[model samples]
Each structure stands twice: as structure tokens, then as C-alpha cells.
Target: METKHIIITGTSRGIGFELALQFANAGHKVLAISRKTPQALLGHSNISCLSIDLSIEEDLEKVTQFIEHTWKKVDVLIHNAGVLLLKPFDQISAKEFEDIYKVNVFAVANLTRCCIPYLQKGSHVVTVSSMGGIQGSMKFAGLAAYSSSKGAVITLSELLAEEYKEKGVAFNVLALGAVQTEMLQEAFPGYQAPISAKEMADYIFNFALTGNKYYNGKVLQVSSTTP
Candidate 1:
């Protein structure tokens, strides 16, 4: 595999951390961003880890400038940072909904915009959503805000694909199923997933590397039956 400069968010732990590990271990330069730094990722000479909360608007600009100066163009840009809030419909407030959208949608949009000028012809932009965002997926009943934000991300990816296809930049969204991670545990309390975070991360990393070859402007719903 060629050494590519990859940018991934939410790398404090779970899927994002594993994504960084896999790419960096493969000798790729991984620009891992997260609100908190993962201790293990620090030892990798190939990974440049940034501890910045994407929800903050100012931080987005800083990331854009940092990537501009450090890497001329991003080979793979993965918008993997997201927030999950399980709240009943009646109890969901504007602030709660906005907060989730800021991380899951707005931040993704803003960062992608910043990277547009630097996106190479074959660059791939992948957004990590949840199964909750898919129309036919089984809903767990309390992820209205979270799911809606993800749904918006799916649409955003499609729009970007249409807008950038002429430039050869591919955009896609992955509606991921339940994975055993801290976020999953918090959202579905006590639930066990059929797959681990590392497993999902491996699949995502490989898919991000080549999914655009056969697909773009598509939402690939990846799921495993849960008992």
C-alpha cells in the first residue's frame, strides 16, 4: 500500500484510535484528531495526534491550517467524531439536539469545506454514521437526536459527492451497526455487540481505502444481527 496522509477524528479511543493505528502501522501518515489524546497512540512516529474538540468552531480553523501546512493534500479524510445522546422524544431539548448536530453534522461539514482546496483528485471523504441513521435499520427508540444528525450526515455526503465528482473526490457515508465500544455501552447500556471496536475499525479502514472505487454518494449500511 502506498504511504498516504490520512486524517481521522475521534481518535481518543475505540474505532478512531484503531483506525489511526492500522493506517500508521501500515506506514501511512495518520493525522488523528480528538478531544482527548489516547496515550498509546502517542508512541507512533507515523501518527500526528491532535487533541482539539471539533465542536469548537475555532478549533476547526486551526485543524484546517495545520493540515494545510503539514500535508499538502489529504488522501483520506474520515469524519468519525460524533456524539450519542439517548433521550426520549418528549424530553429532547433544542440544546441537546443542537449539541449533537454540532459534532455530527456541522463540524463535519465545516472541516470538509476547509479540506476542499487541498483534496487531491483521488481523495476519499468518508463519514462514519450509525445504523440508526438508516431507514430500515432497527431503531433502539431513544436516539432521535443522534440518529437525525447521522441521517443528515448521509445526505451531506451525497450532496458533496455530487458537488465534487467532477473534481474526482469521492464522498460516502457508512451507517455502521452496533460495535462494542464505550459510546455503544453508554447509548444502549449493558448491550453487547457482535463485533469489537477493532473489528469495525479494520473494516472501516479497508473500506475507506477502496470503497470509492465501486461506490460513491451511497450509504452502505453494515449491520450484524443482535439478539
Candidate 2:
């Protein structure tokens, strides 16, 4: 298999961390971005970690510079970092809602823009979304901000796909279901998810590489149960 240069965000833990590990284990080059770089990922030669808040506009320069100086190109870019705000709609503050959009929506757009010059034909851009973002899907309380932000990214990816279609770069969204992670635990206390973070990462890893061949501007609902 050809070694791919992959950029993944939210890699400090959960599915993001597992995706980085799996890609590196398969002999691909991985740039893992998060607020904190995990000690475990440091041991892998194939993995490079960047500690930065994606919500910050200037912090993204570090990522673009790294790609320009090191990889010179990107085969896949995964927008996986997201902030979840689980609070009553009536009680959620304006700042809190904007904060979630900063990371979940604006960051994705900013990072993708920075990556456009580096993305070549056959490159894929995958945005990780949530089932709650899907229209007519099962809605949950306390996810007004989170779900809406996720939904925004879904539309963003679709528009991007259309804009970049002629360039041969593909854009897709994965609306994931319940997965056992720190985020899930914090969001729904004592609620056991049917799938593990590593399992979801495995699916995402494969899809990030080859899904563009069969799909573009598509949103895949990767959930086994209604959430």
C-alpha cells in the first residue's frame, strides 16, 4: 500500500488518538493535532503531534507550515476535533454557543482552506459529525449547540465538495453514532455506548483512505442505534 500523509485533529484521546495509532501502525505518516499531545503517540516514528487550539485562527499556521516544510502534500485531512456543550437550550449562553461553533464549524473551514494548496488529486477531506446533526434523526435534550454545530459542518463539507470537485479532491461527512469515549461519558453519565472508540476509528481510517473513490459530497450515518 502507498504510504499516505494524513492529518487528524482531536488526537489527544478517543477515536482521534486511535485513528492516529492505526494509520501510523499501517506505515502511513500521521500529523496528530490536539490541545495536548499524548505520551503514547510520541513513541511512534510515523506519528507527529501538534498541540494547538483549533479554534484559534493563528494557531492553524503551525499546521500549514508543518505540512509545507515536512509532508509537502496531504493525502487525507480529517476534521475530528469538536466541542460538545450539553446544556439546556434555554440556559445556554451566547458565548458558549459561539465557542462550540468556533471549534466544530469555523475551525473545520479554516483548516480546510489552509490545506487546499497541499491537497492533490485523490485527496480526501473527512469531517466527523454526529447523528444528532442529521435532519429528522432522534433528537436529544441539551444538544442544541452541539448538534447545530455538527449540522453546520455537514453542510459545509457538502459545499466544499462541490467547489473542489474539479480539483479531484473529495469531501465527505461521517455522522457518527454513540461511541464509548470520555466525551460520551461526560455528556451522558452512565450511558454505555454500543461501540468503542477504537472500533469507530478503524472504520474511519479505512474510509479516509478509499471512500472518495466511491463517494463525494456524501454524508454517511455510521450509527447502529438511534441516539
Candidate 3:
């Protein structure tokens, strides 16, 4: 396997952190971005952690500069950063929806667009969506903003895949099920998931590495029906 230059967002914690660690451990150069740099990534030679708030447009400069100077090219770009707004649809304010969309949808779109110059043929872009985004899954209450934002992410990625198909840049979305991560814990306190963050990270890492051959423009729903 070729050593890849990978860019991952939301590496401050949870599945994003796990993905960064897995990539670094695999000897890939990982550029991690989050609102704040997580201690676990600090001082790691293989991992370059950038403190960038995706919710703010101004913070994207740091990422742009890194992609411009550091690698000059990227093998994989994973938009794993997301914000969850668990509230009744009627109670969800416009501001709350905007916040979630900023991180979950717009951030992914903007970053992917900006990184096009850095993306060579055979490169891949993966967006980490939720089961809540796609319909026909277990409908949980209080996820209007979060779910809708993720839904838009899926649509955006599909369009990107077609737009870049000739360039060989593939785009895919993973609608993952419940995992034992901070996001899941916060959304459903006291709920236990058989899948761990590390497990999901491993799957995502492998997919990001080579799944593009047959999976471009696809939305794969990953859920454990182990009931």
C-alpha cells in the first residue's frame, strides 16, 4: 500500500481522533483539524494537528495554507467533523440549524472545493454521515437540524462525485449507525453500542484508502443489526 497524505476533520475527539491515530499508525501522513488541537495528537510527528474552527469561515485559511505548502497534494480528504442538534423540530431555532449546517454540510462542501487543486487523480473524498441522514432507518426524535444537515452532505458528495469523475477524484458518503463515541453518548445518554469508535475508524480508514475503485458516488449505510 502506498503511503497516503490524508486530511481529516474533527480530530479533537471521538471517531475523528481514532481515524487520525489509525492513519498515523499505518505510517500515513495525517493532517488533523479541529476547533482545538487534542492533546493526544500533539507532539506526534506523523500527525500535524491544526486548530481550526470549521464553523467560522475565517479559520479555513489555516487549512488552505497547509494544503498549499505541506503536501501540495492529498490522497484522501475525510469530512468527519459534525455537530449534533437534538431538539424538537419546532424548538430548533434558525441559528441552530445554520450552525449544524455550517459544520456538517457547508464545511464539507467548501473544504472539498478548495482542495480540488490539491487532489490528484485516484484521490478520494469521504464524508462521514449518520444513519439519521438517510431515510428508511430508525427514526429517532430530536434530530431535525443534525439529520437535515447530514442529508445535505450526502447530496453534495454525490454531486461532487459526478463533477469530478473525469478527474478521477471519487466521493462517497458513509451513513454510519450508532457507535460508542462522544457524539452518540451525548445524543443518547446511557445508551450502549456494540461498535466502538476504533472499529468504525478502522473501517473508514480502509475504505478511504482503496474503496474508491468500486464505491464512488455511493452512500453506504453501516449499521449493526445485532439485536
Candidate 4:
């Protein structure tokens, strides 16, 4: 297998951490980015970690510099970091809503822009979204900001796919359902998800590697439940 250089965001825990570990263990080089580095990922020969807030523009340069001075190319870029804001529309403040969009939507766009030059043909860009983001999906009252941000990224990926189609870089979105993770627990306290973080990460791992061959600018509904 060819050694691919992969960049994954939101690796502090849950699905992001699992994705980083799986890729590294498989002999692929992984650059894991999160606000806080995961201790368990340290010492992994194949994994390099960066601690930065994705919403911070200047902090993103560290990633670009890392790629220019080190990896030089990116085979896959996964936008897995997201912030959730669960509040009634009326009670939500503009600042709180903007905060979610900054991390979940704007950051994805910024990071992808920084990595565009390094992405070549056959490169895949996958944005992790929620099932609630899909049109006509079961709507949650409290996830207005979170779900809307996810939906925005879905459209953004589609547009990116079109813009880069001639260049051969593929972009796609995965609208996921309930996955048992810290984020999920925060969104729905005491609720048990049918899938585990590791399980979801495994699925995303396979998809990120080869899904672009059959899909581009597509949103796959990866859910088994309504919520």
C-alpha cells in the first residue's frame, strides 16, 4: 500500500482520536490537529500532533508550515472538528451561534484553503456532518446552530467539489447519525447511541481512503436512527 499523508482535525478524543490512531497504526502518516493534543497519541511513530484552535486564523499557519516543511503533500484532509450549541432559537445569543459556525463551518473552509496547494489528483476532502444537517431529516429544536452549521459545510463541500473537479481533488460530506462520543453525550445526555466512536471512526477511515473514487460532492446519510 502506498503511504498516504493524512490530516485530521479534532483529535483530542472520541472519533478524531480513533481515526488518528487507526491511520498511524496502518503505517500511514497522520497529522492530528486539536486544541489540546491527546496524550495517548504521543510516541506514535507515524503520528504528529498539533495543538491549535481551528477558529483562530493565525494558528492555522502552523499547519501549512508543517506540511510545507515536512509532508509536502496531503492525500486526504478530514474536517472532523465541530462545536455544538444546544439552545432554543429564542434563547441563543448571536455570539454563541457565531462561535459554533466559526469552529464548525469557517474553520473547515480556512483549513481547506491552506491545504489546497498541497492537494493533488486523487486527493479526498471529507467533512464530518450530522444527520440533523440533512434536509427533511428529523429536526432537533435545540440544535439550530449546530445543525445549520453542519448543513452549511455540506453545501460548501459540494461547491468545492465542483470548483476543484477539473483539478481532480474530490470533496464530500458524511451526514452521520448517533455515535456514542463526548459530543453526543453533551447533545443528548443519558442517551445511548447505537454506534461507538471507534466503530464510526473505522467506517470513516475506509470511506476517506477510497470513497472519492465513487463519490464527489455527495452527502452520504450515515444514520440508522431519526435523531
Candidate 4 has which clashing residue pairs, if any? none
Please list the C-alpha lDDT of all candidates, in the order they appear: 0.90, 0.96, 0.89, 0.96
**lDDT tens string, model 4, 1-227?**
99999999999999999999999999999999999997899899999999999999899999999999999999999999998878899999999999999999999999999999999999999999998889889998989999999999999999999999999999999999989999989878999999999999999999999999999999999988864
TM-scores for every candidate against the unseen true structure: 0.96, 0.99, 0.97, 0.99
What TM-score does candidate 4 get on C-alpha atoms? 0.99
Q: Give candidate 3's TM-score.
A: 0.97
What is candidate 2's lDDT per residue for 1-227, written digit by digit as tens?
A: 89999999999999999999999999999999999999999999999989999999999999999999999999999999988889999999999999999999999999999999999999999999999999999999999999999999999999999999999999999999999999999988999999999999999998999999999999999999974
lDDT of 2 at 109: 95
Scanning candidate 3 in windows of ten residues, the lowest lDDT window is: 218-227
The candidates, ranked best first by lDDT, are: 2, 4, 1, 3
RMSD of 1: 1.3
Q: Report lDDT (Cα) of residue 41, candidate 2.
A: 99
Distance from true location, Cα of 207 in model 4, Å: 0.4
RMSD of each: 1.3, 0.7, 1.4, 0.8
Error at 8, model 4, angstroms = 0.3
lDDT of 2 at 161: 97
